[model samples]
Target: MTSTLASPDLRRRLEGIQLPDPLGFGTLMAPVMAIAHYRDGAWEDVRLDALDPLSLAPHTQALHYGQAIFEGMKAYRNLGTDLPGTALLFRPHEHARRFNRSATRLGMPELDEDVYVATLERLVSTLDALVPERQGQSLYLRPTMFGATAHLSVVPSTEYCFVVLATPSDAFFTAPISAWIERRFSRAGPGGTGNVKAAGNYAASFAAAAPLAKLGFQQLLWLDAVHHTHIEEFTAMNVFVRRGDTILTPPLSDTILAGITRDSLLRLAGSLGLSMVEKPVDVAELVDAIASGEDVEVFGCGTGAVVAPVELIGDETGLRLPLPPFPVATRLRRHMLDLQHGVLPAPAGWQRPVPTR
Candidate 1:
């Protein structure tokens, strides 16, 4: 990978761009992106360039074989932040580790963590102004890797491409969201790509999540693949439920994605005077606890969705599990956001500062 400085003309083009007021999630794209190609078993020519369409062969292996993975991250700018004018990226090294884990699972080449993180720093540093300064908005970064070879064979592609795109956006779920309990479809089974950020895992999830949009639900809650009795997670987030001062989430296994936000929350729960539990959560017990008026509050957390309270959990038959006021989630969300936007003093190496050249 190579580091090429942004020219003066490119900087002017980026500065001239304007972002709309709403700044919806994943809709608006930044003017620049970073890309690198993997060929002859080595990555080469990585550089920041214009975010333009790619000219690819018709038979790109990623198109047919689903050999692609991506990560969700964000960069925060200064306005409305405690450290004014200071830009920060939250735990980029953790994201890098997860990205490489996904790549290794797909039989793809693992990107060096240093190169992966430096690429993000270079991109955000060049386009720091594109990061939104709104309270719940920031520069959403997407780093994707795919098998770009045109061969149609079942073997792993010899060539791959890694690209990073940024978008200024708001929270994925702006308000409290309802989730549909998926019993008919399973996300993954034992020894599957459930832990990896494989593109196919999400596509397979659409069979259950897609229909929820029309049903007045915002997310789909997944259960274990073996018996469908244990709670796993959500479509794109990690699941957590609160009972009094205790927060519980399912334990990570080969069938669960170890979410970065989830880990941070578990680590921070003690500071919030909340106990943490990581065990196999049975669906029946969860439903019963909420129905018994135990003040059960459910929430989902991830990079894009961040901290979204699940207002209701229901199935197709119109059976809704009564939800309590999700105050715990709100407090936790604010705490994490404060740490991200510099309102609170973050833990050691929690937030990495960007060197704006």
Candidate 2:
């Protein structure tokens, strides 16, 4: 893979930056970023430059019309480490596939996967030391493409800019969480951008979720945007439930974000001797299962945090489902993290090591 832009100024900027001791998730930014612009019917040369505020025109289309998509991934320094620590990526290809899908859904051009992957490799290799080395620590990579042209009408912008930035941080969550089942606001409607990781989808959710934090709910369980009957996802993560040996998760409906971690979990379930089901799991059914003591565990999965077990599910009716005594979520989380950190034997081609030093 060849990078089009690499400068002494950018290298000096990277060397001059100082990161904190315990980097929090998405809090600390790497000093440099990779950017590429799409205009005039072609992708321009990829540029490596210092991380700085972007300059936008007075009427940028993305700012007004909300034409953008992004992807989140983690690169760990877990591979090739011998003494105590080794890092691994959970399922990066999954993110790549979804990222392109998001672009397609929003009327944006699909970035060539070869170019995308090569660009990712180049950036990861360049920021190798910034890859967190501790257990559960990683460099959170955010790749985003947004409309760059100015347009008053609702048409897609002809120009776009894609950039990749990294955030070095420890585990996103060291504890379980209590979530609320949002019965009022729907994250996506039928024939909407629910399945895609679009910027507007998240902006639409903030109106409903921001208020819930005051009520003490860590997150909201978004429903199917049409009828608001089924469980869709929580913020950007997918939902799952476990009953005995059978693992059940919401099906990949058009309104659901197909998570890489979700796919990895389903694949790993088989080898772990667990039965898996992918279908439209009703939120009411889940609440009933918890009330009747059938649902053993509940969790959410995404690139940020592989598995976050749900301790409570609060509803508008004052109902809360307490998670039953079972470490299925914990077990699965450990396995996934282990596979990512190289603590356990990795699946062939699941991880790619960074050659630094």
Candidate 3:
């Protein structure tokens, strides 16, 4: 994949910037980014450029009306293979698929999925030196698109911009968390943008998250929007609970975001001789199961952390249930991470190796 604007200035900029120690999630950024503009319903001017701030008008459509979408992905350094410096992207097409799905839902233009993957490839290759080689660390990729037209109108903007930024970072969560059971505020409603990775969906969650953060809960286990009885998902990941010998998770509904890591682990479950079931998990039933001395565990999966075991579940009423330290979640996380880091062989098309310039 060639970038129309991959230049020597960009390479010099990359050389001058060094990766920082103790790389936090999305805190340290790569020196460069990739972008493409869409105008008159045509995508054009795709380029690899310096990671610079945008010069937008005050009436920019995205700034006012919130028509933006994004995707999270990563490129891992080969951890165990003979190729030491190899960069591998875990399920690029899957991320592209989800990105387009988000764009479709947000009334935005979708780029060619091939171009999307190629843009990522070029970006990672350009920042090959910055791809962290440590286990549980990777070059995080965030692909974002927004309405760029300077319009005060409420209708969708005619112009759009898609940008991809890279972050050299570690896993999103380092420790197991006590998830606050959110019954008061809903993350996504029935006919809302819950399923899409639009910017607004996360913005809406901050209201619920801020108070929960103060209460010392690191994460939130969101219940369904209407009844708040059925488990939907975590704020940023998909929820999986292991009950006895069977594993249960909420089925895919319009209210839940379909996570790529969640699907990958589900696909890997059968091969590991695990019984996985997809059904609506009720909060009350799960609380009862955990409180009754039954062997139950809750965990989450997403692109950032891959898998995080939920240490405790609770609500404001002082109803807290402790979960077993992740047994199934650990196994699944290790397997998937192995596949991602090239420690183990992944299925065909599951890994895409970026060519280093």
Q: lDDT by residue for model 3 over 42-157, one digit each (tens)?
A: 98867988889988999999999999999999999988664666999999999999999999998998888888888888889888989997878899999999999998999999
State the lDDT at 54 in candidate 3.
85
Rank by lDDT (best first): 3, 1, 2
Tens-digit per-residue lDDT, 1-357, candidate 2: 235545667666667556677777778888889898898888887777788999998799999988999998888777444433333555666677889999988888877776776677777767766777676778888999999997777799999999999889876666898889999877877688888889898888788887776777787888876777788789868988787777788888778888888988888887998888997778877888888978478888887878888888898898877777658888888888877877777677788665442
Q: Assess candidate 1 and give its lDDT.
A: 0.88
Candidate 3 lDDT for residue 315: 89
Where model 1 places Cα greater than 4 Å from the true spot, the runs are 79-83
- TM-score versus the correct structure, for each prediction: 0.97, 0.93, 0.97
* Colliding pairs, model 1: none
List the global CA lDDT of all models: 0.88, 0.80, 0.88
lDDT of 2 at 77: 70
Model 3 clash pairs are: none
RMSD values, in order shown: 1.4, 2.2, 1.4
